[model samples]
Target: MCNEVWLTSPNSNTYAQENDDHDAKSRVFCTKEDCEETFGMFLVKETMYLPERSYSELIRSSDTIRNARFKSVNWLITAHKRMNLWAATVFLAVNYLDRFISIARCRDWKSWMFDLLSVACLSIASKFNETNGHSLHDFQVDFVDTCFAPTLIQSMELTVLKTLAWRINSITPFSYIHILAQSVDDLTKRATELLLCVVLDHEFLEFKQCVVAMSAVRCALDQCVIKTSTKNVTFGHLETFIPQDQKDGMIECRRIMAKVIARDREILIRGKKSPATALKVDLYDFRNFSADDDSFLRTPEINVGSGKKRKREEE
Candidate 1:
């Protein structure tokens, strides 16, 4: 029964060919004024199609490309502070929550609602964390102002808290290790520090670049130690640190770091990756005390108007 229906369906080649021919003739007839006027009177139908130009052309244009580069540089210099930080925080929190809910459970109306609720909670938490004076009620008011109902806002806040906790738990181990290595006096620590200092000074702003430098360093150290007969178990006595192999991994790491830093700095200075921008308004309130300025004194003022005037004009 299904086979028979499939064979005689409108999707059949004969029916499709006839429909295509009819569509072509109608399109051709519509292009003519008399036929369009006659067709328009008979059929009061709306056209569904709209014309579109390719975005690739705009992206490829020199001015557009230059502007995009400038925008990227501006973002790096300002650390994306010109845009609403709250909006960005909310978006990031919501997106992460949505991903977590989608991955842990099936996508449905219930899941979507749960994700939204989670995002709101996390946003509130972040606001509270960032601004010590802000209360939960303040967050609630802000949420409502954004057009969310009280019930939805409350639910979202709960979900966001849970989602954030889960994400933190997953990355806690790696985060701890990364933090620990920074404070340690080991060779790995030194290598990592050099890598970080180089990369952080540049506009790349990615941990993966640091990882690549670390990997290259490790590989070079391993190759250098392979030639030596004595097995130095302690990191301090490693051959890479003492004699230093010309083809050592640490050398390669330093080279890579230098190259990345040099390239990124050039890009940044050229306004291709780090454009000049104003400091964040929120950061303006922060004050720094200088010990050197403690002994500085204000000189006594001599008022010109209060001084005795010469009697030359009267004479």
Candidate 2:
């Protein structure tokens, strides 16, 4: 075929484009049949990428770490929305950030370190989710006071990749949503939005990605967007995809998702500001402090013109 063919890989939910020669350098894609046959394997394999501890557990010991985690998540979310990238990108970026934080145990981490790490995670995520994503510098240009050089960002990216053993093909809630969507009608749009809402809140971190996906689907079904005669049957089939131990959490998660959806509705009716608005920070206010903060590094230079930036010694 001379034209472009867009195909969804069965192993993952992300799309891949194949040119006429079937070589557009896209992610390796499998057909729908492959997804169905190996869907069970995906469920079993998702646990490998999940964080050992929930977000709450990871930050329980330090208030500073808690604040940094919250702020980093918001920054990632804001950047994703600003860039108009896929929701999965931000979710994956946060997943990478959380996993790194959990394993690295960087209790002495500074705000600027989180900023740079967030950039690196987002850069990696954009590549995962977008076919024609922004450049590395494009991601750094929006940082507070410092623009990280390409090499610095690449170094951080490599650190993250190695930390996770190069397992960047994470199975997020979106992945399960993409898979389960095959069984039901119209599960993509609303379910995905609900999943995005859930991702923004750290509470969902405790639940498995499959559970979260099911909860999002149940929530979407409740929204009455999709008409189905065997809703319970559909749910039963979806339930089978989750592990036995996670089933209980799925019920509780669905309840929490209900509250979240209701709260979202109330915000719309009351015309209140979004939670995202509250999460926005005064980048300028912290710029000076972060610029001088050597906690994360000797410090990358402020220049964005070159690949390599000079590292200034601690004064």
Candidate 3:
């Protein structure tokens, strides 16, 4: 019941200047390979497993995937747009979906189940990531599926929350993507989209987020097919930024991602048909939106809890 800064707060004290300064200093000589190695070390404990729920049906093997597709990507991205969520939030939600399925051992998934999970994952991820996220009611407005009631979605959100073990503060490729994108600011958007696509498949889960991001950039560059070399900067130019030891892995990452892209190509095409270009989502919709009275869906804020408050609290 104490005063807390909502995660929605851009000025949340959780992100103090000290952390930023430390991160800035740490990345001075941090190559993508170093980032990948570091992430890979910790990724063993938690991360999205492969055969991504978005296109799980299409993938038969690491390299072999059917030409079919799923809207799990498009629907979630559209929801991301509609909810005015952070790009990272969408990725985290997808990661959550994959992880939840892996941990819960829930197979024999129904088609509509994917849609329901999409909504539930969106709500849960947004709540943890953005402080105040959309309610079941708000999501239904955009999704327009009445079969799964708001309460039902709320229940599913709890199930997802439990399945994730309340560890929603996941480390994603975006953690390193922002820093790497700085070197190639012009291609951030395109690179980020490619990163999203690659992560949708479980195949890339074995690799660290940093690796996926690097390979994604390669894939993005391949698609763009940029040839000009200003400052010797062409597509996949960042490959040099990786450590020599990890170079082969990076090369292979790019290769596997290529197949992931090929399999999801048609799905990606279909996903584009959604109203991705719609107007900006009005976040105020959730200002008073709640699934029920005293719902966990309505978190107070993204407070930087005092270290004294808990054994692991960073404050």
Model 2 TM-score on a 0 to 1 scale = 0.71
Give the runs in model 3 whose Cα sits over 4 Å from its true position.
1-69, 131-133, 142-147, 221-247, 259-315
TM agreement with the true structure for every prediction: 0.25, 0.71, 0.58
lDDT of 2: 0.62
Residue-wise lDDT of candidate 2 within 89-130, one digit each (tens)? Answer: 888898898877776666666666677788888887777567
Per-candidate clashes, comma-separated: 6, 0, 8
Residue 284, candidate 1: alpha-carbon lDDT: 21
Model 2 residue 166 lDDT?
54
* Better model by TM-score: candidate 1 vs candidate 3: 3
**Local distance difference test scores for all models:** 0.30, 0.62, 0.53
Scored against the true structure, residue 216 in model 1 reaches a CA lDDT of 28
What candidate 2 gets wrong by more than 4 Å, as runs, is: 1-36, 141-144, 183-186, 226-235, 266-315
The prediction achieving the highest TM-score against the true structure is 2
